[model samples]
Target: MSHHFDYPSDETLDISDAYCFAGAGDAHGPRTVFGMNTSPFGAPTWNATGYYELKIDTDGDYIEDITYRATFPIGSDGTQHVQVEQLTGAAARDRTATGMIITPPNAPIGQVVECQGGITLFAGERLDPFYNFIPYPVATTTALKDGTFPDFPAAGPASDSFANTGVRSLVLEVPVKITGREPVHFWATTAYFDKGHNTWIQVQRAGKPNMTTFFDFANGTAKIADYNGTAPTIDLVGRPAHPATDPATGIWGQVRDNIAAVVEAGGTYDQLPHAFPTPRAYGAWAADRLLPNVVKFIPGTVALWDPWCDIQNGKGIIEDIASNIIKMIVNQDFSSGLTPGPVLDYFPYLSTPPPPAS
Candidate 1:
């Protein structure tokens, strides 16, 4: 349920979503995770020139609290080594990578590189962890505009279409203490420093699942690259905040309009809660799902539990949005397919890929 292959390059293909698993481990008093795919669908090189960043907000304000930067540098043997750093203070914008731990990427699908600062790093090919049955292209191309999108209530449980696909995943297991052990929001981005330009340009980013798959190309229009290049602050909150009637402003604004248009034209209000009572009310509730694109992980909890969903469920200001829409899309059934097989009961929890088809 993400913008897989929505962007125009290998760098942006299949960047599904930032998947979170909390209390999956407790090697360090309690651990939380934030993982995503980068340069996922090709024989791409994660060599010395690229940067993978994970940003966290501890204060619930949606601002970056600490940034964790991961990079791959070529070693003497010409193999890529994973190096990570914690960026605090002004280093987030300044791009200063301090506090370093260098190690090789995971190997044999079972080896996890235990890095410094109670963090574990794994970068390798793994079975795509995300699972769902919706055919996005079919849904968006034919139904969204025509207002014939499938009805989840009437439809049987959707199949898992991505069951066999693989992604170049970057997974991190960070201790709660480092993250201040509170409710924290996290997102991932891929960037590289341009030697000629002497600057960093973001090429890919993801926070909430399905942002690109559903909203970026709302109403049959493409904001793929524009959405990728914009920062979360600007994308979620406008350059200068304004009323809902303002022009299609940022990413969420465009998405709200897109969903509202579809909701209005398609008469899909029956899909939303009856409490909405009206189309406008439903649109407003549906639109609130898109802002502050990040995953909220309350430390030391089982993932998808009521408490976890509670903290993650409350809608904050424009600075934040809960994971309710996706949760809601699942139709109140919480225990199925959230994290199917391929979950190892240890560090770097994704399961090893199946052996090649016989």
Candidate 2:
């Protein structure tokens, strides 16, 4: 399963956060599950009252065909309530459309609220499921500058940096009938109602795990808003054409060069297809695979992230995605060497949150 964990403290306004896509079959039939985690400890709670949305594209076009959105409002007792809606066609693309409400208004957290048409909703705080070496971002940034991949194991012992942290989570399960039986593209976003503008303003969008973290490190947080506000279709084909020598022309070029630089520094540039003998060529190819970032899920199939080719086919919550991404970039069979935490086997598969901190 692909997930995003935004780390920039100053850019908290653009933190749209984690995503997981999985499909399973049961006696009732096949179902698709979408998971999100946001508001890391001490961060702004923009997503709490804002919107957490899942957009699905049934055909290959990268445009959304369906949207499942959830909103949380805090009760007087300081507890959060979740309300979900389903939108399709034009409404799916229109952020202002109310569409159709699927779950009852203000459903309590930590309890599964069943809605019509076999949809299940759960929203509450949960232990963060993403794992990685604590200093991964720093190490990657240094690697880009010094022309060498950092020895991750040398920085520290294997451990989950996200341990002991919690995030507000929204989990939604819908039957395949609503999402369609064919393979679909998936991406998630977070938006806040901008009363100043009289409309909801999208602050963040994500698909693949760590795309912004790993690839955008060199540019700092300068592009966070542009990256978050735009759609995948823009990343796929909307970039301005530029000469090969200038790799900083568009977001696509920036991301492509970022991937290429990391791989080249890791000493794997030569291993890419010999047809593209230069780093820019290999980077261009690699960027193409990653752009228009969205998870592709075929209903009733195993949801596994292909570490070898970076081919995403949905993501399970327990997958060691950090290691998988490292392996994909370096073209080496390496891992973060960190052990992952456990998750539940039933609905709301994320691990339970630790008892309230003392």
Predicted structure with the largest TM-score when compared to the true one: 2
Q: Tens-digit lDDT track for model 2 on 1-358?
A: 2334454343333333445465456676688887666666645343466777888898889999888888777778876677788999999999878788888867877788998778888877788877776566456656644556767766776667788777777788878777777888888887777788798777777787667656553244445566777788877542446424444545676666666677777667667332345666666765665676787888767788754665677877767776666664555566666676888878888889866779
TM-score of 1: 0.79
Please provide the root mean square deviation of candidate 2 (C-alpha atoms, Å).
3.4
Q: How accurate is candidate 1 locally (lDDT)?
A: 0.57
| Candidate 1 ranges with C-alpha deviation above 4 Å | 12-14, 24-28, 96-99, 102-110, 134-137, 140-158, 217-220, 238-248, 270-274, 305-339
Residues 152-201 of candidate 1 have per-residue lDDT tens digits of: 43433456566776667778888877876678878777776778998887
Per model, how many backbone clashes are there? 2, 2
Q: What lDDT is reached at residue 169 by model 1?
A: 75
lDDT of each: 0.57, 0.69
